[model samples]
Target: MAKLLMDLTPLSYSPALRRIWLGGIFSTVGYSITGVAISLEIYALTSSAAAVGAVGLVALVPLVLGGLYGGVIADTYDRRKVALAATLSMWVLTALMAAHSWLNIHSVWVLYALIAAESLFQPINQAARGAIIPRLVKPRLLPAANTLMMSVGTLGMSLGPILGGVLVATLGYQLTYSINVLAMTVGIWALYRLPAMKPEGTAEQPRRGGLSSIAEGLRFVRGNQVVGMSFLVDLLGMFFAQARPIIPALAALSFGGGEIGAGFLLAAGPIGALTGIAFSGFLKDLSRQGRFLTLSYAGWGLGFTAFGLIAWVFDGQGQGASVRESLLRLSLAGLALAFMGWADALGGVYRSTIIQTAAPDHIRGRMQGLFIITVVGGPQLGTAGVGFAAEAMGAPLTAVMGGALVIITIALATVRVPALWRYVPEPVPDTRQIPSV
Candidate 1:
């Protein structure tokens, strides 16, 4: 029973790691609150879902640019400094957002401009912080540490939005934004306490943190089969298997459950993620991480495929019997989504552990940056692709096709990049070997 529970090895191993993890969760909750407030505030101002959606559009370019360049910055300077700078910038931005709300400045464009700035700095902070984690813990514990950090962050993402909706509804946006500012202080302190984490290669290489360096990072990933496949595989997995955007359509047209049903389907994924994270203790012993990751990701596609099949087979159960039919349908659909979320979270844990263990320290910032870019971009593309497909073939076929493609793509990748399938890791951070120039 103990072996099946969530691993606490990393937390018990290092007090600093635990502090940073808790601080990160606090900051994540705060940002999530601001995220919901921003969306709601924009909707109120423009009364256009499209206008509200433009918030992502505003952040898109900056997210890529920051993610790339921010990695360069992290590699070039003291990572703690980079994190501190970004955190302070974010703090001021949150304060300004509060000021905007308190002063009742109802301009949508103003909101767009603020969101754009915030988007840029956010990635810089993320890149620096991600780069710092490997320096704090042994390579063997990376998976456990990541599980703790990611699960809490995911928890915050799940709870924060609901809390944000409540706060925005009752206490108003100004106060909510202020609370975000306050929430950041702990993270700020965490970053401040972190020791200097300059890229180890900086001393010997003395390379400029410029476009050339960024290109070099890109070339390394392209040339390195294992690391490269990690990114590519993750993109493909998320690209083909993501199911969030199709939930509303499935709820209404397929299940006949309307808004209430949609709400249950929506919460299903997060609940599954939390449950899986809680019982991820067995993951610490897995040696063939690549195969584990591949299998978990495959489960994600299967779960979505199951969801579509169940919804299509039931087809308007809510309209027929109301009680037994609806209960049975909601349970099935919810179970499928819950399964999807579990698979997604477990795959992510392995993916992160792979990158952190596989990559060298000096270039880890850039690798982590590329990860952030994939994280931001992959789901957006996946959702857009799925939404278009759903419009044409309806829920059942679209999901099945999407899941099929995900499975096929991964199988092909394992064939091409056999190194990924055979990969294993040493138990400690490899500091003796320098990165290739």
Candidate 2:
């Protein structure tokens, strides 16, 4: 029974990794709080969903560019230093946000600019930290490490918003941002304690840290079938199976539970993901991560399909219905979302492990940089896709259709990319190091 619990081998084996993991918990929770606070504040000021949503839109370009360039920087400089600098920058940004709130600054543009700055630093921080993981743990324990990271991240995602809401209601946005500023100190401390992590093997010339470096990372992805497929599968899963954009509408229109239903639907995914992570011990022994990645996405699609079917059946019944009248259907919908979250969590665990383990050490930072983009950018695009489709076909049909497309696309990709499907983690030769071109 104890063996069924999440393996603590990585934490037990590496003190450095443990500190970093603990620090990440605080940092991620803090980020999650700021995310909700920023959106709510924006909406309060503009009273437009589009304006609130534009936070992502405004930050997206810098986020992508930052990720690509950040990867280059991670590979070129001391990864620890890179991460520390970025983390401190984010901490300063959070402090500034708190000041803005406390000072009664009502400018949405100032808020947007802060968000954009944080977005720029985030990829550098993420890429450096991700690349540092393999250096901290044995190659065989990578999955366990990845699992721990995911669980911490999912916990933050799950609890951050709830805590944010409570803090804002009781203490106001100033305190909420202030809490984040304080929480960030833990992450900074973790990075500070780590030994300098310079890239292994031949260093790229300083001049290479430009467009050429970004091109080098892209070229590596193009050449590596397994790593490329991991990104592709994740993109397809998020792009088509994303259901968050419609949760509010589904709660009000189909389940009849209104705001309460919406809250449950929002929480269900992370709860489900946490549940999945708790029992993910078996993944450590699994060699064929590629096959599991495919299966996980299939499960995600099925989960989404089931959720959509429930809504389709309950369509138009939720409007003006009391909570008691909608309880049963909303419960079923939450269950379906739980399954979707669980499956997505499983995919994330394996996909991340494969990338970290399979990619060569030299360019791992660069790969992780591009990976950060995919992880963050994919869902934004997916929300746009699902949101647009929902407008035309209703949320239920959009979910059903999108999920079906996810299943079909993954199945096809697996069949088409045999190299990806057969991939197993082993020591990858650093033959394809980024050459100055």
Clash totals in order: 0, 0
Best model per lDDT: 2
Please, what's the RMSD in Å of model 2?
Answer: 3.9
Question: Could you tell me every candidate's TM-score relative to the true structure?
Answer: 0.83, 0.87
What are the Cα lDDT values of the candidates? Answer: 0.77, 0.80
lDDT of candidate 1? Answer: 0.77
TM-score of 1: 0.83
Per-residue lDDT of candidate 1, residues 316-366 (tens digit): 545534324466787888898889878878877878877766668888888
Candidates in order: C-alpha RMSD to true structure? 4.1, 3.9
Write one digit per residue (lDDT tens) for candidate 2, span 301-350: 99998999999999988988766888898789989988988888877987
Q: Which stretches of candidate 2 lie above 4 Å from their native place? A: 39-55, 103-111, 165-172, 202-207, 251-263, 313-330, 426-437
Q: What is the Å distance of residue 50 in model 2 from its true position?
A: 5.0
Q: How accurate is candidate 2 locally (lDDT)?
A: 0.80
Worst 10 residues of 1 by lDDT: 428-437
